[model samples]
Target: MIEVSDPNEIAALARDPNLDRRFETPTCPVNWLLLKRSLKVLSFRGHRFPTMMPRDDAQRTSNQQDLWNLLGEKVASIKTGSDELEPLADWVRGIGPDVQLGILVQQLLGQLFSSKFMATEASWDAAKVLVAAPRLNNLPLMMWWFVSGKVRRAKRLLAGMVNEDLSAVNAIGIAVHNVVKSLRQMRVLYANVQTRSGLSAEAAAEQCLFAPASVYRQATAAGQLGDCPYSRHSLFVLSIGEAARHAEGRSLVFMEDSWSRCPANLWIPAMLQGVWNRASVFSQFHDEKLSG
Candidate 1:
């Protein structure tokens, strides 16, 4: 892992798979975006990269423009299965360090959340969001980003529901009742997830964490009650903890002592229900697990 301070050094390391932590301390957001975009181009085709390193600033500027042009073309043609989507998807997933795609995704997600995209009422604006979304669908990196967004959205929706008036509360209660009913059906499917083909829940959960699989497995497998500060079914629980910390605008490590570490409450029942709903649908529709 290279802890590069120079923008040029960062760009140089983008092509190499040896470095695990590509973007180091005090992350330069613009440099990170360019590196991610450049890596995607390299993954799509090795020969697309410049054959020689530019000697002068002018040449470097031209090369940077070339890279940007390539990214524009790729992002523009990134339609779903319209000939460019699969290749782009493959390129993003195939990039080295396995974190480049995640970086690109989080860059886009940050833009989506901070920019006016989420609040856009125009259908064409929403359509543009969908196009970018489908390009990374079903990929592990994309799933992590999506799950992060889903968890955030679920919390926001839950909070709004609880904060509303009586009529709104009644409506929210009805929605919750239906979700509970759906979850009962899904729990049956979770029981068979290990035996079924395609992606397993454990595998999905593994991808959600920022830690090693062994660490996660050890934590979940131990299942020692009150052994740690908090109880967690799996390592992925840490993601929820991190997300909650971010939402509260505090350090994630600090919350570990309270809500994250051995907190006795499974207060995320609605979020869990949403996961079950999606899991069951994917298994039944894509994995053919529910067929007679």
Candidate 2:
């Protein structure tokens, strides 16, 4: 396995035709088995999570492009200053000063998935298990979790909450969790900023837009990406979140220019900005009421 964190190298490697999302049979038998298990945990009812599907998957490509176009329409509408997100902003504003940050963010993002979506305390508990299952590096423990039905239960709860929409599952299950983490970070930064009024909502949102921690690719054949050399079936771990920390690495947040770029690139930042804007307004009003 090769781990890459440099922005330029990641960009070059991500665009390389030889490297793709499909996990080919690795040279190591143990690794190959582990990859198969990973795919199992990441899939539901025979459908691989959209993000986990191979690049060459025609159905995935077509469906994802449709989602992208839909998100683009949402972005355009949002840009017109609609009040569609005021409810979410109000939820953020109403958060108790000492509320559990993780749970609060998860609940807030859950609303974005669907108005019918509701996260109970038990759901949050299950989510912890579900989100961590894919990241477990131990084969034995992973197998034990699966066999013991722990993983299956968590997945069932998640699927039920999202009405079995795989895209919603992927978004809430794998993607927006990082966005939640970053929003928490942004909240801390907003609180500590000496000149909060000077920070635009858009700027504040951009300050916390985080990329996924990493994405994997497999080489179909021996090839060189920048200075890195890889053999067939070698796995490449692109450290997207790390690269996004660099000055010019912001684009990596959404992989904005890449073939695999996130569909919600514009919509996410806009939604975040709207939340921060409403929250700031509420804060100012509360401060004035207290002072008066």
> Against the true structure, whose TM-score is highest?
2
How many backbone clashes are present in model 1? 5
- lDDT of candidate model 1 versus the reference: 0.29
Model 2 lDDT on a 0 to 1 scale:
0.74
Worst 10 residues of 2 by lDDT: 93-102
The CA lDDT at 111 in model 1 is 29
After superposition, candidate 2 runs with Cα above 4 Å error? 76-94, 97-114, 138-140, 290-292
lDDT of 2 by residue, 20-113 (tens): 8787654587557757766877788887788777887888878778878867767655643357655545545545442354455555556656
| Per-candidate TM-score against the hidden true structure | 0.19, 0.87
Q: How close is candidate 2 to the true structure, as a TM-score?
A: 0.87
Once fitted onto the true fold, the runs of candidate 1 whose alpha carbons sit more than 4 angstroms away are 1-100, 116-254, 258-280, 289-292
Model 1 per-residue lDDT at 129: 31
Q: What's the lDDT for all of these models? A: 0.29, 0.74
For candidate 1, write residues 1-292 as lDDT tens digits: 1122222222222222322212122224543443443233222113212211222235434644553453344332221122312222232223233323222222222221133212122322222232233234345765664566632243233224234221222222222232223233333345555533344434432222221011011121223222223122222112322333233322221223221121101111222323433444444675565463
